[model samples]
Target: MEALKKLFVEFLQAPTQENFLKVRNAVLATEEFDPYTDAIDGVPKMMEAGELEQALEVMKHALFPNLVLSPGAHLNIAFLLHKLGREKDAAFEHHISQLLQEAIEETGDGTEARPYLVTRTSDEYDYLFAHDLEAKGQALAKSPDGTREHDVLTTKDGGQIWFDVTDIRKVLARRMESDGEASE
Candidate 1:
């Protein structure tokens, strides 16, 4: 995990496709990687409680240690920093968020045939939020041969978007298998 952490830092420093691939591969190979959770999970509640500083601290601490490749965490941190009057830091985080987002967008267009690739479900919402859209519904889908998985989102404006969430699917599958083994 420490080596994976270093890879993530390196990728943040040089956010290119090659660096991202390294991080992605490392994440996928690790059984402990859970794309469903992040340190920033508590931020919204903290914000609602007016504990901005605490929320920011939680986000920073969890940013790297956790498998949080989603842009939403950075965006949340940026928003918190901006609210705290740290424009420079906020801008930097916002930039990082955009870089991560661009990496996902470059994977494919948001169509069923060519869905945008994302590591976490939060990223699907981030992509929609970035486009000023809202999801009216969501469903999991698979390729015709059942080799690939996707998240098909129906937009409020009666449109649809797609995300290739294969990594997340794999993570969930592994977790389910482990749970079954534990129960037995």
Candidate 2:
């Protein structure tokens, strides 16, 4: 656990893409390394190869040390759990994802590598956009000239721009739809 914490801090100290890759490589090279990246990478490949059990195992063993990586893993794990007809487990994963989202929103300035925290709705949306996790059905209202109209939400933390409750709903809906299709 200490080594894992060290690695986590090192990654946070320099959160750049290049630095992340470097640290990831180092972790992979270490004999004591948890197979976090391997598991994350193998999931899609295993799924594509119809190795459902293997994919599920990979997701189940994934370790998340921070919110930076937790949200995506939680989302993926939730989907996989649902695919396996484990509705309760999937819901737990989704709840974890929501909690991680909230944590990210409340986190302070991150390391020099990734300094910005998604403390506001606009920032969170931007983070999702960058990660290709944008809420699918929550289209922003656009003007005739194509500029989006900003909708603000005030939370106890501060003012968040372009906040939409539908974003959260869409995320839940996506998981539900995936399960629904699997059930059918």
Candidate 3:
């Protein structure tokens, strides 16, 4: 298993189309491997297939910029960024990764998916705030007219839809915020 993991890292170092295929197959075949590893393999393979957008989406969703790649995500994201013609951003990610590595070593904590709420989608960063998330079923529908109720909304494509409350965590939990921080 350790050797296989090393093989994956080596694939990252010099990911040819062939290597990408090999790693992609290995990730899909192995149940014990991390989902992020599967994502790492999928990204580059998809890129080599000329699917750049799909590759970028995977890299962004994994927060790969913040991880150490030779293990997978780190290196793949770097390569993908370079392929995307974002060299400066790639370099910045590498620099930030070094800092992230230092933090990891000092804290000795493994990666955790810390959910951040989408505060706003600006041109640059999609601003997010830390929030708790829980899953529910699609029933407690919210009305578009401001009042919460069970209702169906019609789409422009001549489709009808009923909102699912349990599916979307509409419960807004309050967190104390300093006014000074919000203004900034």
Candidate 4:
């Protein structure tokens, strides 16, 4: 666990884009992820290192157990994989998207990489746009729009779900850091 933490921190600390990608690939090979705690910590840490691809791969892999990767992971891998031009694989993943959606509803938590599963009843764009706003500081009006923006996880139908970083930041800002730490 500590090694995984160190790997993530190292990935975050590197200065060059070259080294960052290298470390990211290395971390993906490590095959260690804990969603509730470690995987959650690792994602931002990887992004901090500019290893979004690696972080996604690691998280997607962590989301599965056998059959190379799970259905949800395949969907997530498909999304990212498409960005990387892995179309055939992505098309293959399309088949499993519904199963992934079912698993997500069963879990009731949008922690999985990609959980959206659309049906004839609901449109994907509708589900996607619903979460375009964030709620912070007060009332769940909408999310931020600038650099502080975060995405809302959704289903294929586009129903918005998952953590919103904008709100997390507000809560953290209001929190006291430590016993001896100042509140400034």
Q: Pick the lDDT winner.
A: 1
Model 2 Cα lDDT, one tens digit per residue, 1-184: 4565465566555544444444433433343333223446767888788787778777666553222245566677788888878999999778656655554543333222223333123344544543445343333343345432322322233433333223333334565677799899
Judging by TM-score against the true structure, name the best candidate: 1
What CA RMSD would you report for each candidate? 2.0, 14.7, 17.8, 15.2
Models 1 onward score TM values of 0.88, 0.42, 0.32, 0.30
lDDT pick, better of 1 and 4: 1
- In model 3, where is the ten-residue run with the lowest total lDDT? 122-131
Q: Whole-model Cα lDDT per candidate?
A: 0.84, 0.49, 0.39, 0.41
Between candidates 2 and 3, name the one with more favorable TM-score. Answer: 2
Residue 176 alpha-carbon offset, candidate 3, angstroms? 32
Pairs with backbone N, CA or C atoms under 3 Å apart (clashes), candidate 3: 69-74, 69-75, 136-166, 137-166, 138-164
Which TM-score value belongs to model 4? 0.30
lDDT for 79 in candidate 4 is 65
Candidate 4: worst-modelled 10 consecutive residues by lDDT: 115-124
lDDT of 4 by residue, 25-78 (tens): 343343332111243246656757767589667756554212221334445556
Candidate 3: stretches off by over 4 Å: 1-41, 64-74, 108-184
List the pairs of residues colliding in candidate 1: none
